[model samples]
Target: MSAARLASASAATAHQRQWFADLHQEVAAGGDLALVNADAPQEIFRAMGIPYVVNQWWSSIVTAKRRAQDYLGLLRERGYPDDSEQYSSIPLASAFDPDPANAPWGGLPRPTIVLAETTGDASRKIFDIWDTQPGVSFYPLESAAENDVPARWWELMPRDWERAVGSDRLDLMTGELEGLIRFLEQTTGRVFSETRFAEVMDLVNEQQEWNRRTRDLIARARPCPLPVNDSIPSVMIPQWHRGTTWARDAARAFHDEVAERVSTGAAVCSEERARLMWIGRGLWFDLDFYRRFEQSHGAVFVWSMYLAIAADGYLRYGGDPLRALAARFAAFSDQLYTPPWSAEWYVKEARHHGVDGVVHLVSEDARGSYFTTRALEAAGIPVLELHADNVDARSADGDALTRTVGDWLDRRVRAGD
Candidate 1:
């Protein structure tokens, strides 16, 4: 069967176009804009009524529009490695592009504030490059990994986050978040409201609950009620707007749509043979490539980190919303990229989803990919390790990777079936 597409997905795309138009208009009228990293506390901006764009989201736009190669080329021309965190740094390079027609969304406006967590030495250097612009001020938060790796972090993090992640890490993150609040207040002349931020936290929790419902529904559905392609934007576009009522409503709407599809017995592939799990950032340039496997070999990709992480990663409940938000960002990178925590969660998800094979896209900048592959293989799951950059399409060979997957499915996945 042809892959089932969601109307909500197209609606999300239209909503983003309108959002960018408004953002550009705001900046043209002398409004200050912020360019933030994905792990930054976006609720602070949302509560303060400041318009911000996530760097990863903008990079996805650049990659989807097929401009990542050109942007990276400009970086390479300027003496930076084209392969180094290209997704996070693409928008920065695009700002230097003389041609607006060649840039994504007519180019990103000069940001008044650039916020990013110091995930590593490379990330700090990338944000520092942004600080070189005349008026751009950089704010870097410290990201500390947990020394004690906990099992089932998705379950522990919502309520017992303090135990799952250490207090020392939380202390540093909370301090940084306070500094960030003061910095934003000082820069924008907008007072950070405790009441408003608290309310925003409530809205975010509501949105997460809706995502949890959607994820649970999809997990129990045998053939998979929706395609991973549509679900990515459906969950993520609103995710970038996380603290608003609109984002919460969008989450609920997507959940309802998925429930309705499951009720009608909808399936992305009519003959669902092998269920595949994709573990990494999305392949933004080739989302259609996800569907190509279905027609050729009765294989359907049922899982991606977008919906799963949105479901399990963002929930934090406590009295102090700011500290709670800090806890969320503090261990966010570790839970996804670090050793035992990362490896354990993937195995749990693969088993729960009944995944037949795994496609692990290993990032060069992170650790634990080897452990993840070994653990999955030890668990009796066949693993296909693809060394490629999801954001930098030039570094990845889609045709060759697809062929590799086809061969793996035939030998390992389908052979057992």
Candidate 2:
């Protein structure tokens, strides 16, 4: 890796680790903790003054710590497929890890509530394990694949989402969120306040607005001021804290850092030649992969959905705050997975960032990459489809992958194929 990480990223990492420590202490003292899916309506948890762990987020930490394979073995012992959605499954398996001394974040505090949307095939089953655990309540929201795919969802999602994604879909999600609120009320003995939810929505919109500015800045900045490695945490950590004052400030701070770096002519690779876009889930276990090609090939990964999706995907501005929040999560995960939606956005982003090539990680659970790959190629961008799990390092050979990408860049991008 390059020594080019952003300050906001460093602060965010320290804050989250310490925050997790504090959260573990809270749960030990009999406080409530929820384990939620990335696409679940987190703003609701925020409004309820609850601290939660995102399943995939913690799984990344475990995978990075090199303990994922051990936990996967435990899952296999329970007859769960070792290769099945390892990213989301690792945390669940950790509950049965037997060796708590080796688990991530002191072995993810036994969640009081388990929350997830049945977006992928394995999600419901994964959360079910949490539900069956003593005292953990599981709330599974429904995710649908809408046939009516709209163009320019980034603009429509913020306000006209009901029509953009269909009113029926929004209606289902909004009702489910209402049920979630009632569940929280009954479980926590705390009144779910509309006032707090609205305020939280305001904070989220403010955060996304800052993200939009940062994305636009980087999209246009020639020499790409920061590495995608740094941008991932800079944008994503705040994303997990969407409705907080600190998250809002962090967004602004990151945007300012990117702006300052660009103004000062800073560069991740001063000899930047090829700009690339990552078109699937982040390579969490090997984020250093993004920088590996920088010195060797001058191929810099300028865009990943983490920052761009946060820029384009999270805003919703219509009626009731609760409904708007529901609208945000209703198609949240799908926007990056379903056809037309995922393909269109990737196409738009590749063009916007002036990418020379694409490394599309086609995870088994992530749908629509076939079309995504075709669309990018049709738009005259060369793409290398790397079939592997973003979370599981064992799924692909890291050294081989670097060579594959380097060869692709040299043969296709450098030769203008």
Assess each prediction's global lDDT (C-alpha) against the native.
Answer: 0.87, 0.87
Q: For all the candidates, what are their Cα RMSDs to the real structure? A: 1.3, 1.6
Could you estimate the TM-score for every candidate?
0.97, 0.97
For candidate 1, the per-residue lDDT at 368 reads 81
Tens digits of per-residue lDDT for model 1, 1-417: 243688778888889889998888899898989999887899999999999999999999988988888888888898987888877988888667888654778788778899999877888899898899888999888878766777788898899988888888888989998999999999989999999999999999999999989988888887888888899999999999999988999999999999989888888988999899999888888878788888788898888988888888899998478889987888887777777888888898899888999999886764789898998999999999888888877667889989999998999999866
Regions of candidate 2 where Cα sits further than 4 Å from its true position: 1-3
Query: Stretches of candidate 1 above 4 Å error?
Result: 1-3
Relative to the unseen true structure, what is the Cα RMSD of model 2? 1.6
Candidate 2 lDDT over 1-417, as tens digits, reads 123679999999988999989988999999999988888899999998988989889888888888878888889898988887887888888678677765776788888998988866677788888788888999989876578878788778888978887878878888898899999999988788888988999999999999999999999998889999889889988888889999999999999999999898889998899999988878877878999998888889999989998989998886888778878887887678877888888889899999988999988776877898998999999999998998777889999998999888888998853
